[model samples]
Target: MRIELVQLENIRSHVKSTVPFTRGFNCLVGGLGCGKSSVLYAIDFALFGDPLGRSYNYLLREDAETGKVTVQFSQNGKSYTISRGLKRRGKGISQDFDQLKLLEGEKLVASVKSEAVAEQLKAITGLDKDVFREIVWVRQERLKELLDAKPRERQKRLDELFGLSDYEKAWSNLAGYQREYEGEKRAYEKDPDVIGMEKLNMEYNQTAEEFSRLEIELQGIAKKLEEARKTLEEADLKLKELEEIRNLTEELKRKEAQLQVNLTNIEDASAGLAGKIEEKKNLIENFKQRLSTAENRLNPTRLGSRK
Candidate 1:
């Protein structure tokens, strides 16, 4: 799938920038440290979720990450808009996935991810993180190095042309089958007259019975193999889902801890505020008492102040 366009805001080296890329030969013409590569990584991360980092700060620009990065782009004629934020207050990143509708020629081709507004983009795209990186996109410099390689230096190039190294496997099975058939034919030739013919008939009937029994066993084995594969797949999915749930639970605990810290801060702030308020109230009362004292002193016992 080809990504046709991308729009990034608040990403590294881009405070608020909207850049439209072409479907072919789009070069980010800029000097070093101007965030040329950052744009590429951001585009890959937004469209495919193949970010080059294990953490939130891995691919993002320096001194950033307090704010969010909004990315809008189109892939394989379908458009997508995603807004992601790794706020300073939280341990996990907040993600939003949006499916876009666009007209392809005269018909409207809707994006398939419209069903879930909030999910891992992997769920929306039906692509795992590794597959997206391998099939859809590649880094610019790595592409150049891969192209300049010799045939012998690369390991997998030869395997693609020729089949697997265990190429005699099917041939070996066929040879064994031929040997068994020849032995059966020679055994039939070793018999003689009408009595021998009767014996041969008995042997044929017995072989047919054994063949039918083996066929049933093979069928059962095949069914069990299919079930085994399905069970393996289910187990893998369950493991991944459990991992995600664990991560989410950890995040929830972090949020709860932060909330408790905030409550404590509010309590301390409230106590300080109360003390300041009472101090100001006492100051006003003192001012009034002093004024009354001065007036009595001026009148020489009008209000009975101490002489």
Candidate 2:
């Protein structure tokens, strides 16, 4: 896992700051009280919600009302971002206001509360807080703490980092199983039932034969059940297709009704327009007749005028 960015707001001495990291060997160097360590803590808080078991109230700035941390990192070539917020409740008390969001390129894939966020982060980055602090983060003051630790402590840290603890657990489980098996074996050997081993062997062989026959019957039943399931699935698919066809038929009927209404509206409009055209034609004919009558009245012969 590689950190790409760490942002802090109202965390410890930092008001607002962002640090971008490169691919390899990025360092944080600054004077005292400049929030160099706070950046690391902010990264921890953003990923794990709480910073290394510290209280949320102590991590928030004294004068600030809220604190926020956002960290962007890349693991296995996929980018992720985590953001967390702490809001002051009253004097010397603060509560986690924001749930942790695991985002991939602005799309939230998981959101978890503070209690379960650490485990999610561990699963995502393959490192818990202890392994992270031990391997990735080295404080300026306690840089030699890992080296100066006792052998058991150092080995424990190493075991966690290298996953040797799983091996230890496996060994412990194997020893326990061995002890259990030995005890069972000793009990079987010391039992008085071993004296009638021949009779017990005949009974065991008979039971095994019965079990084999039942197993065959069970397999036949399972095969029939699988075939029945397939038939049911086919029937379900056909039902769905039938439902879709019914819906389409209803939609077609609705569209046909709408088409008929549109056709009726068009016929009404056409009839109204034809009526107006006929009225205009009658007015033109009347005007022509009136002009002809006036012409006939104005004729010279009809008025009895000299030539």
Candidate 3:
């Protein structure tokens, strides 16, 4: 987790101070009592709320009724902002629940509760107050004290600070683990399934052989299926060809019927034309015969018009 910025309002010696921090190691080099350490305290408060054994009077400004700290940080590529505020009651200072908020970017993830914000910050940064105090933020005075301490106390303190005591407790808890393991091993050996291993192995082998036989049969069936598919494809092609031939035959039949109708019409037209021509020839012959008769009966020399 990297702290990007810290804003302190009425916190200790700071009054509306905005301190920007870089990614890597940052040093707050200022003269004593310049509120440099107050910034660190405010950041801690913003992230984890109040630390144990620390008084609110040390954090809240002398006469200020309200104090707030906002910390903007980034963890695992995700940015977060957490704010915590303290309000002075009649005799005791309490958390300003209204100003408490944990935000991811612009979205409020937790609000109005110190426990909720602390839990969210712990989940986000993977560090609780204890871890932050002991490992991440070692106090300058405590370091000197640790160096000046006796060997055994120093070692014990170091173990507790580095979380080595948890390992010691875990090792102590494993005292009966070996006995439990032995008992479980004995029970496993006495299991009926373990005693029947040979029979199970023989059955497995027989089943494997049967599976191989079935696999071969499946391959034969697949081959037959492939041949059937090929036959169906060939049948489909022949059916298509037959359909085309049937269409052509039908067209030819229709054309033949049309030609027959045309031939009958031509024959009827020819017979009518022949009849008309014979009638015309007969009329001409009749007219000629009448003319010849008239010529034979009439005189050719003189006329009898006056008599």
Candidate 4:
């Protein structure tokens, strides 16, 4: 893998910087405090995010709200671009917001947040942060530390560099499994059941008897469960019928109340009608008495006029 371009914004001392590299031999030649190391750190930030041992806040520029790093690299003839960003949480505080994206040409392939982004970057590059820092981009100080390491530590580092760590881990796991197997074998040999076939047969008969008794008990329990289920179903059905009866009773009561109201209204109307009929009868009797008096007076007047 070769880095083609690195872009940094508000990262360390770099406000905005772009560094490009050629195909073969490329070196960053600059004086002290000229951001040469910051460029490399920015590349590391783009690939693997913040270093595990160091605080992420140190990567941010002073008084900057956000920082970003973008790296374009070529691996196996395919070009990939990775971008990462961080936002400050408060004044003089580390950024809480971290995001990363992996793109092939113009198409986005992976977008991850925080720690997952580092994992995805490792998967894409086939090198973790520590391995990349130690083997691919070893600083002068780190190289000195490597030289000064003990023999065992040096061998461990060599194993990591050559990808032999996985094999060492596999061998270690195999030894552990072998020890476990041996221990199990010893335990089996000491077991009383391993003494003779007669003892084994007796134990087998006892286990079979116990299993048979348990099976019988399980069958009884199954029957009880079925019976309980049927009883529950019956109870549910009865509850439904009771609910239906309760609804019908409420309907009947409402209808009875309406019928009582209608009866009261009819009785009131009948009483008023009877009182009007009695008044009409009294008026008719008074008119009949006035007519009889008028006829008697007229008959007397006619007889006097004839004389």
Model number with the top TM-score? 3
lDDT of 2 by residue, 131-250 (tens): 667677766555687788899998877886788989988999999999999999888887778757857989999999999999999999999999999999999999999999999999
Tens digits of per-residue lDDT for model 3, 111-222? 9977777788788888877768766887888768878899999888878767788888888778678779889989878998876985798999999999999999999999
Q: Relative to the unseen true structure, what is the C-alpha lDDT of residue 206 in candidate 2, on a scale of 0 to 100?
A: 96
Candidate 3 weakest lDDT stretch, 10 residues = 298-307
TM-score of 2: 0.50
Q: Which stretches of candidate 4 lie above 4 Å from their native place?
A: 92-99, 114-116, 160-307
Local distance difference test scores for all models: 0.62, 0.82, 0.87, 0.83
After TM-score superposition, the amount by which residue 190's alpha carbon in candidate 3 deviates from its true location, in angstroms, is 13
Query: How do all models score by TM-score?
Result: 0.37, 0.50, 0.68, 0.50
Task: Name the Cα RMSD for model 4.
Answer: 14.4
Q: Where does the lowest 10-residue lDDT sum fall in candidate 1?
A: 94-103
Instruction: Give a tens-digit lDDT track for model 1, residues 109-212.
Output: 43334333224354445655454554455566655655776766443543443444446677888899999999988876775665588888899999999999
Question: On a 0 to 100 scale, what is the lDDT of residue 243 in model 3?
Answer: 99
Question: How many steric overlaps are in each model, in order?
Answer: 0, 0, 0, 0
Q: Which model scores highest in lDDT?
A: 3
Candidates 1 and 2 compared: the better one by TM-score is 2
